[model samples]
Target chain A: MGRIYLGVDGGGTGCRAAFWDTEGRRLGTGLAGPANLTTDFDAGIANVRAAIAAAARDAGLSDDDARGAVCHAGLAGVQSPQTAARAAAALPCTRARVDEDRGIVIAGALGPQGDGTVLAIGTGSFAGRRQDGAVRSVGGWGLRLGDCASGAWLGRAALSATLEAADGMRDPSPLTDALLARMGGTPQGLVAFAATAQPADLGALAPEVMRAAADGDATARGIVAEGAAWMERALAALGHAADDPLCLTGGLGPLYRAALDRDGRRFVPPLGTPLDGALILARAYAEG
Target chain B: MGRIYLGVDGGGTGCRAAFWDTEGRRLGTGLAGPANLTTDFDAGIANVRAAIAAAARDAGLSDDDARGAVCHAGLAGVQSPQTAARAAAALPCTRARVDEDRGIVIAGALGPQGDGTVLAIGTGSFAGRRQDGAVRSVGGWGLRLGDCASGAWLGRAALSATLEAADGMRDPSPLTDALLARMGGTPQGLVAFAATAQPADLGALAPEVMRAAADGDATARGIVAEGAAWMERALAALGHAADDPLCLTGGLGPLYRAALDRDGRRFVPPLGTPLDGALILARAYAEG
Candidate 1:
């Protein structure tokens, strides 16, 4: 049988897998629950396998065919060399490689030979640049320490502003009212919600803030503006040059596109998704 | 036996109980684990009982004597009327009253009849003012939404700054180096630490930041200045008058006292501890 390659992108919220033939023709894709290896290594491995199996099935491949495929997995929380090595060795595939998820974004947004910056704004945020096959990153310190322009950060900012309005530290506005209503109509309710919320749970509220901003709520608009400003700062810190190709990727990326000042910067469409980048690596490994 | 009164000061970190007789003579004091009602109602009730039992034992009181004692509990996370009612009903006293922890701070810092503001800066931070038997407050929304000048806030700010320095977003300073060393000398180690850290756990790092600030670390100094500014804002929002008696209370209170601009504000020492305030209330209930 011809060689089949599997690409996996695993993150805090979920995992995705894509299958492609040796000629780079897409076969199918599948998704599963959170696969952050540091949080649950066994669960991450399980989900990665589940996604790959589903993708293979979707592509009309038998179980044996799926097991024979070479895989490349780009995973979050693979920071340490030990974790990367362990993850690679534990994969279900006969031949596989593990890399940091950030690398996939760089390869996806800017191709392997491409050089520039990718501002990934999602449930979490990260900024990265690639030059001469080397990648450097800033931010993505998780939702607590950083992730400045991320959906999680935006939601957290909105919640703080809403509570501030409730406390009269800031003026009450439509945004605060909407947020309070959504959170059961009281500042105390918001407190209860925040007490147990995970980063993604908090990030789920980003849409509410975005909606309010779209409707011209001052507080919401201010939050979006602040987030955009932070993004600009992150881009600058990542050494993004004016003429260098820049791609904004991830769920919140499109929302922030208009807010960001793109003057003198070459805003380019991403060459491919992280999954596609993972497939590129898988293909290379299978050929080798 | 003379009437015995118990004052309980319960919070997120720990619980304190002070026993006194009707004549205002202190008998003994005891401490127990965290007793934030909403977070862990059963644990809070148990801790409160344990603290009172310990105090009673220390004062050479029998179980019956402890059961007959009037108790006043000032507890954190007693937000809603239902929680207050439930907490009051669950206490191990013949007669009892439940009040927000913030109220106890006001009474402790400014006496029952005194009218002014109290800036309680501990693992958390709160600002409250009492006037004509009514109390108004600003901030103290917990580590997530508010608590701007709190130890948790300070620690979190320091951590973020440390990460920023590590990422080259900010200049490396002694403060960042110290923080990294404490967390295992790596950014990834800090990330792991933060992933599992509770609010009190983060608050424990505040002293490190304070120490660095005292040693002239620019990042640490900036964090302290920012925290102090937040305190000033919180006090003002609590309707603090120019000449109002302003008292800083809590573990970190004295440390922040020197940093806060007390211009035109009447700075005063707290008349007693929260347990003292609780005892006063218990005494009133027992006598009445």
Candidate 2:
């Protein structure tokens, strides 16, 4: 009954919270709406608050006790240390820390001090390696400039090919035809959709490309192959060694891992969810 | 002294006006500020009027005469026929016509009825063919959707490569080095610049790539070669024939033409400027 730990896992889609007693026992977990700080800092904070409250209630802790809990968060859109500090300051706990959601994901996948790489590719993509307690990352600059091999990237590539095909520049394929039909059967309609689409909206089309590629659609297959090649190159750039533990995390991570060749790398399962990663960081902070 | 023709060529950078008499004599010409109707309709109209007024003054015509002058316009951002009609209705002339700037460029290059293709590449890009007085076009969908082979496209590609190189996903070269230094000396700097930069702002970097390519920079050479290849495909998609007259127009047009192979292609000089094409259309309308 000395103290409690609250771990927050925040992302573009939603916020989740878990409670753990100081004795290393999991108490309860809660979920709430999106908490992507970069795109919606206010909403992110609000959701994080709601998720924490729910977790505290589920753990049967008093409101005051919940407020006194030690907390650490791995959050999306923590583009700078200042933003992470701002997030920590905005939280309810007396001692709260925040880091990038990707970092937490990597930590959770490979453990606090595990040496390996995490290829996290959901709505966004980033390849991160934790080596000898050192962490480094690649990509994840967002859709305008980077984020290659991400869901948004795949969807955008399909849409681009569809437009080029519609313009008669490329051969029309089943994938392009189906995509154009879904996008209002006109290039202008697709263009209108893309003109104001957020990252999630574009990433939303990933399933269609994936499904089509699985079914052997030529265009979709090409896009996915190109993405796989990009992933290999990015991973290589991060100095991914042949014997390193490769844990593919995030919504699209497993899919990519399956598609990638396995001869040179050692594939491993994630030890825990991102929340567990956040919880591990929380425990580390308390110990320090 | 029967009827005077006013040809207005409006684009993102500025507007120009030219006058011609029934006797086929060149009257005068005028220039004004930016007049891209798509992005700034009111400003476009104002600039068009200013340009027309100056041309009328140069042709020794009064305000009433200028208002009475028959006008035809080839303007940037006229995306649809409805937009074209709206532009004509907003003009001072009782009889006015408006069309996509690329159309008039093609008309000007091929003399309205001359069968040929025009590869117009500037801040924007489009491939158009005039066949037996009928016209068809491809790939003018704008920066987000299309606009391949354009100045903006080239700049964006170079920046993308620079970011990849910075991340160590690809090898760095002199071209990427110089470009990264110019773009605030970092990937984040380039990203921030691109986040809000307009098409012209991005296109402003095209000359750098062109100059670098000329100086044997591998990255710059690759970008230009890619652009040239896109042009060839788009032109071919528009049914460019082996013996068809190919006239390159716009700021980046001739640069691409030079890079492309001349085999199976007939290169020709443009008959006149876009203003001349607008004037030709105006004359045809008055005669009918």
Candidate 3:
């Protein structure tokens, strides 16, 4: 039987799995609910398994074929060695490797021999650099302590600025009024919404901020600029040189391109999706 | 039956109930668990009731006497009029007035007629000013939106700065090291801790930051300065004048005094505790 490779990108919001043949041809893909290991380890494992099974089914593969597949999962919340080991052990595949989601993001953006950095700004944000066959990352500290320049941060900043405007701390803007209206048309409503909002919930508002920024709203423009500044700081921390190739990935990444100071730097396109990077790892494991 | 007044200071950490006669003589006091209305309405109501029951028991009063007592409750998370009305209705008192916890704090610190500002910096932070029988407030937007100089904000800032130091984005300090050590001695550990940390849990770390600041830790000092700056912004927004009397209250309030720029303002001592304020309100209600 030919070797089957499975790649999984498990994040706080959802999980996606891709299946491929030994020849590097894509077979099928599947998606499931959130799979952040730290938030819910059991649910994460279950979702990963479910995604793999669904991918196999979509590819017309038997149950045995799915079980025999070699898997590489780039998962959120795999921060520590213990968590990585635990996640690896929990996978249904006989041969599976678990790593931080940022690694797959870097690989998918830059490929095997590519040098430079990738700044991923999605529901969460992280910057990764590949040098000397090793990957180093900065700022994927989740929504609380870090994830600066992330969609979550952008939305949070907008909400806070809107409240400030409401309280006359800052100039009122159409953007703030629109945001408040969406949050039940009152500052108290926004406060209520913020109390129970998760990272993804906040990130969902990022597109609105971007829309307002594009329309020249001062508060929105300020938020986007601040986020871009944080991204620049992250890129610098990742040791990106002036001429280094950089790729911005994730949902809110492209929105930041114009805002970022790209002087003397090359903003390259991503080689593939994180799923592709996961597949590459899976294939390597299957070959061995 | 004599007119009995009950005052309840309900907070995120715990609820305190003080019983007094109409003439303002203290009868008894009781303590119970957290009673933040928004977080858990039923639990808050139950705790308030339990605290009152205990207070009456300590004062050698019957259940009927406690049930007939006029009460005033100052609770956390009574942000909107609807929540306040709901809370008032749920209270086990003949005549109850429910208000935002900050009002009681202002009353306790400045007295009913004392004009000026009060900065309450506990697990949550809020600034309020009393003028002409009305109270105006700013920056009690909770842990997510505002609460700038709050203990929760302080702990969160320390954790974030510690992570930046760990990532080489900033210089490491003893304060960060000690904080990291408490959270399993690693950045990963800190991330894990942050995922599930509630406001009160984060607020618990504020004293450590204060201690480190006093010991001359640069990171700790930065966090303190930032908090003080936020307080200043909040105070300014509250329209505090140079001559206005300002009183700082709450667990982390006094720690901020040395960091704050008084700018020729009179810093006064709190007239009484929140319980005292609640009792005063209860007396007013009873008299009317």
Q: By summed lDDT, which 10 consecutive residues of candidate 2 chain B come out lowest?
A: B255-264
State which docking tier applies to candidate 1: medium
In candidate 2 chain A, what residue range of length 10 has the lowest lDDT sum? A256-265
Tens-digit lDDT track for model 1 on B226-264? Answer: 998877777667777789888888888878766875567
DockQ of each two-chain model: 0.66, 0.65, 0.59
Q: Cα deviation of A75 in candidate 3 (Å)? A: 2.7
Which 10 residues in a row give candidate 1 chain A its minimum summed lDDT?
A279-288
> On residues A154-207, what C-alpha lDDT tens digit does candidate 3 reach at each position?
899999998877776678788898887888877788898888898888999999
lDDT of each: 0.84, 0.85, 0.85
Better of 2 and 3 by DockQ: 2
How well is each residue in A1-288 modelled by candidate 2, as lDDT tens digits?
778999999988889998898886889888999997877898899999999989988999888888777898998878678999999999989899998887778878888786898888888888989888888888887788788878998888889899999989998988899889988898877787888888788888998888888888888889889888888887899999988888887788787765786777788988988898888889888888
What's the CA error at residue B75 for candidate 3, in Å?
2.4
CA error at residue B261 for candidate 3, angstroms: 2.4
Model 3, position A183, has a per-residue lDDT of: 83
* Candidate 2: regions farther than 4 A off: A30-34, A40-50, A62-68, A262-269, B40-43, B46-50, B62-64, B182-186, B262-266
